[model samples]
Target: MVSLICTLQDHRDDVNWCAFSPTLLATCSADKTVRIYNTQDFSEVPYSPLSGHGYGVHCCCFSACGQYLASCSTDGSTVVWSTDTGEIEAVLEHPGRNPVRVCAFSPDSSHLVSGASDGTLGLWDFRTKTLHRTGAVNDTTMVACSFTPCGQMFVTGSTYGDLRLWDLDMNQLHAEKNTHDLGVTCCCFGPKILSGSGTVQFRLASCGQDSTLKIWTVSRSNTGSCKMQLLHTLTGQSAPVLSCAFSADGQLLVSGSVDKTVTVYDASQGTLLYTLNQHERYVTACAFSPSTPLFATGSMDKTVNIWRVEDGHSGHVETATFSCEGRKLLCHSRLLVSDWSEEDVGAWLCEEGLQALVENFKANNIDGAELISLTKETLASELNIESVGLRSKVLRKVEELKAGCVCTGVPDEYLCPITRELMKDPVIAADGYSYEREAIESWIATKNRSSPMTNLPLQTTLLTPNRTLKMAIGRWRTSQ
Candidate 1:
């Protein structure tokens, strides 16, 4: 595994907020400049220097769709920038004291929220470019506020060590929890909305200067009473947590801390998975990709370090499939997506489907050169799992195609079953390698063992589901 660290060309002065985009990343610093860098080459890109704020930029974030960026400044002003043109589209000023430290956009891109040192929270409508509401927050200087993915609710935290959840509809406090000992620097919501498992509408996580991280299970009872329950507290670290981000699936959490370390933990179990001690100074911000199983951490060390997780592969074998399906299922089960685009999505899924075919061929014990010849002619053919059947001769052809290739897919194990989208850290596997919907089809084709199964005229029915399942079928067995 190769790890790359990114640093600015000129050292930034008092950089406060940094956000990642699909193709580029933006950073706001005290030097009165916002620098945008290409994610691929780490090269600095030309971005118009925004200078309306009198003092400095404090916090910034990219919209969920990556179309707009919102930033707050010490001058109690907020501006929305067009990601394509690097032009300021809207400038909003809050008549508050001191600086506006943090701002976030709702998931729908309709509302923007800013928290200030003046202990006030300001809300604005991005569509109308008008202030919608302003309210006095708790004594804690409201530093960070984020809307839940649903956009119906938002949570705000402050230096006074208070966390408050609000309902935008009723314009009332849904719940309030004062559990931190210091300034609450960062917070994130869990990916999965709790439904049938219990009343959990969402999971909230926050970190503060108290050197403690807490997780809360927030639920709305049928009677309309919102309850915030303390779920777990992580307290092994001695440093104040600066920023926290949940993995794509909320299965894992990553925290950047003043202790110069980035810690990874199982969000559900609160188990420390790994600690990256490579940064030289305090870690400022951490983010995980929704498309790929990779994490990015920005630090006072003035660098963004990228790290990847490893998944184990069994072995390669060859098999023959005499039967032929009309079309193929292009499964990109193993390809990793750091930032996905339309073209990337199509290419990844196609590659993964072919990879599944290749693995099946090898497991059936097929030859290499023959597989290469098959891929050269058939890879571009559109194939869906519903149309494919597991006949022995067909499986052999799949082996032939994959042996001619390297890197069948991404290394992450918890991938989407259909689209083969790489699950983020804390990813939960609802089904097979792809999304849940596609996983069922994969299972039917690869499994469904009861009577004798047929690849060609040959009948092999003794194989149980466990034996034929992708998780178990291996070409090389040590015990054997």
Candidate 2:
């Protein structure tokens, strides 16, 4: 369900990090630069090529409000810049060649927290433009940092297999069990959940050098101590998992790995859905666009790959095998008119006309969203379909699909066994099961002489109308 959108090649060196605002994207690179690009155009901002960092920028993050951008680098400093003007507003200098490994903006955009390799941690206030606190997380190298949605607390992780939370200047251990056996590389907060009784819970996802991703459910206790419970541990990457990003809705998660692949999973079930392997080198970062079904991945290959997630309920059929190469189409879609007879097409478009309409829009290079917002007349006109009869049939089919169904409360036994939908024209098949005429015909065409539900051998291919079932269905329809 992943389709390539476009490829961005602007960084002269390895792109180490990427972040997304509501409508813009900012990337940091080993080229000693940070560039912000409009999501609309995917072009660098006019004043971008921001090159204040004396060394490679290792990480970049956007404030919750999308008004500011923050970056950390091996130059031993962190800079906060205005996203609109591309101006550096604050500079906090440290004392090392070691990269400031991790940084994140507070939920309120009022503060930024950063950590350096040697356990050096600092919290800076945006208003004062000064480092308000400097400390260390024990004696371990901090690799990951994130703030909760409410901005009341922030979390930090170490290369030493530990996770800690900061609350009003007090650091508290949130997980009794270590997240991974090795160093934690990245951690991001998942979507928030509010229970029926008003209890709040947040999901935290982390990946590490152990080559595993772990999800932890966390909550605040009455005494204000964060309580943690292990939810699930996902393991598939052959190499260390480098980064993970959660969709804004918290239903999906994408993790990058040193195995040179990006794995997408259902966040709630930990079910692996897709594995993207376009990057030649290790995938360094992953970011989900907040306002669209889009995500961008950056790697050591220095190219940013954009992808779109498809949301159709995929049928167990090979739809198409065409790529954007040589303008060739070798498709096998069941719904295409070229592949199906006119009667079959009519039958299919009758039951599932909405989906077929979308498929037509796709094939005709029409905007599918227009089908939703445009009136039937306007849509039909916009399609500019060559065959007037075909256009009328399609538009009439759409109206029938949209018109409210009058029939309801039909007996399940009178329904089509093959389609699981209420029968329009019931028929008796050789297998002796009642089904919609079109449904059983389709089943026989696809499955030969076998029963759809039982797979039993069929004695004949002929079908007869079920007069009894038809009468009952007719009465039900009339009553409704």
Candidate 3:
């Protein structure tokens, strides 16, 4: 059931978007600035709002790692912010009158993808801070874009009521279909809702000017490949369904509408659960906490309401205030949102690289393409990804991308302090930092008994391989 936690006047103008990070909540507005609030330390008011765009900011997003914040504007530029210091790291601008509608970081925090009113999409490299790809493949003004949990598949909706799915790795269109009868305003991939046997079953929930919320059944094969099919079409909102989000466990779906209402549904059975009517104006956006039962909604009335999403049986428990208990809150753009599938690996690719590897490894499996099916961990550990040194192989590609480039220094996060080279085997050391396994091992054996980067006494000589970093390194290497 739905229960109000608290309401905050998050913006001076219509709050276009609001997302939670582990420690903060960031909101964007037509006022042309972004404000961030501390989740745990509410004693201090928010610092000065961030502003640099020529026009009102339309959307904002905090990278998965929570190290950076990105905001897009009607002026056609996106600014990346260093969250800790509230400093701008990069200002990304594209030529044309196409106002950016939304922006989001790939789950791995390796790429930033943005959609525009001109039906254009741009993919920017976060590590190198460069715009590497742009496309005008859609003819209608695009309304929203979402990357599936793996980042291999991308979904986009347009004003003309159509949806297009693309294979990011192949850089090829996967499917195009009409689900909404009018402008497709927003869409999000459902969380992994599983069956009794522990099998994954997910759905795509979309909202539109048509006043209908469409639920789609996403079917997949043994190989991590999948397809979407119409499952259930929910119609009850008195006006346009402005935005929607799935609970982290995929047990619930929450939607906001121009009717000034919020609806909750049993995601598995597609049954109405609860309806919240606390807003004075149109509800424009909604989001759920990454690992809690908390739900939040943003509206044109200039307030953000946080709610507790309980099971249908609980009815509603009134909550006058909300507490983080150390839970990081996150919110995002018009449609760009949290990862749809698996948990975010601290070091990772986007699904684009996962897609490429799946397709390439299909022939080698005894189970054929089905064996390449993507599971929760992405690829199962049983697969022979290590047969040929995966670390060294991908690291070499990274150096190749730097050949004759004009960027300044290499992104420090991706380099190994010991060797000052792109890391092939990244591992976490005792000091809660990452380093190239070989390089750090050598440091401990021959160099001083201190952390090379911080010069602190070594806590331990042990190093654990970081699988996430391996995948991310692979993606950047291949994309370049």
Candidate 4:
């Protein structure tokens, strides 16, 4: 289920684009400003209403590390700002001094690309703040740009209704003509790289004035040849689709349309999931949070609406008593086994259909911590269990608990500063702190250049995997 969470009405003009970092949301508008908000409470940041652009801002995006924000404008410049302080870091003028329509940062945050009204594209080296190259298509406005997960290539959509793929060297790799009957409005590459049988594949979603959203599979074979194939054409929204984005996991797709509606789909299956009708005017922009089950949509009415996707089990009708009880026990399974009390252990055994063992567990005063450590020897000797098969079943259930439990007592140090979630793939950042690899990478790509904990400038954007911490977390999980 999806429900509206909040509506932000701070923008004074048409909202042009919306973007999200791990912990923040950014929206640009025709009022010539960019606003930043804390995702935790949906509160505006202290230095928000960023006014660097001389003309209406057209697009905005965060650097991978969440250190910087980039916004383009009709002023013919793409400005990069320090997300920490909301100060302009650099101003990159487009080659032809044309109105900049869209800007995106590469996955590694090493490059920033800005597309212009005259079809000119500027590729900038983010670290050195220099223009690395320039390329363009003829006679059409460049409106959309997105880099592939591998960072070796990117896709661009233009007013001419064409989608073109280009390598980092500014060479055109492939082009699909008439992708949208009228004009292509936006395009985004999924966050994952799928590889099998000597071919690397990517998913791309593009929406257009044709009033449809198209999913395409772009693949590169071992021989270096590339191909693009249409996978699905979504028609949930009746009016022209203006913007589209993929969830961080690439499992869901969302689009905003001129019909004053927002549509979300199961991207993998090409099935409509929900249609939202909250905006009073044309919906122009939409974005999904990289680390949470939340999405934001912006409209020409100058409002931004935040919506949340709830777990499927929520709000479902219980068909049977056993099913309701099973659902309740499943919720409890999220608690760390180490923190479970004796009663919790007893309840767990009942839920596991080992009701005969409940009294045995309670008689010996076994709790969650002890339950996780149980083995065949303990079941036979300490718990006084006689049946070998029963003991093995109990041990197997305990093992499953250790592997699946997502408990609340995770050590603070083991949580990513950006997402505030327990780190699965921990990595040490240049800030000398550990974070989930994907979280920090998303932070670096889209937020400020400072340490999330220290509020001090980060010296570099490099991150090193914390394998030791990863192993420690694994051990802790097993112990729980």
Off by over 4 Å in 3: 41-48, 95-97, 193-202, 219-226, 317-480
Ranked by TM-score, the better of candidates 2 and 3 is 2
Clashes of 1: 43
Q: What is the C-alpha RMSD of each candidate to the true structure, in Å?
A: 23.9, 23.9, 23.7, 19.0
lDDT of each: 0.59, 0.71, 0.66, 0.84
TM-score of each: 0.61, 0.64, 0.62, 0.66
Question: What is the model-wide C-alpha lDDT for candidate 2?
Answer: 0.71
Clashes of each: 43, 0, 21, 21
Ranking by lDDT: 4, 2, 3, 1
Q: Write the per-residue lDDT of candidate 3 for residues 72-152, one digit (tens) a residue.
A: 976668899988888889988754535678887777888888887666788888899887777765457666777667665
lDDT for 39 in candidate 3 is 54
Q: Against the true structure, candidate 3 has what lDDT?
A: 0.66
Model 4 bad stretches (over 4 Å): 313-480
lDDT of 3 at 181: 75
Q: Per-residue error at 179 for model 2, in Å?
A: 1.8
Single out the weakest 10-residue window by summed lDDT for candidate 1: 449-458
- Root mean square deviation (Cα) for candidate 2: 23.9
> Which candidate's lDDT is highest?
4
Runs with alpha carbons beyond 4 Å of true place in candidate 2: 95-98, 173-177, 193-199, 313-480
How many backbone overlaps does candidate 4 show? Answer: 21
Residue 144, model 2, lDDT: 89
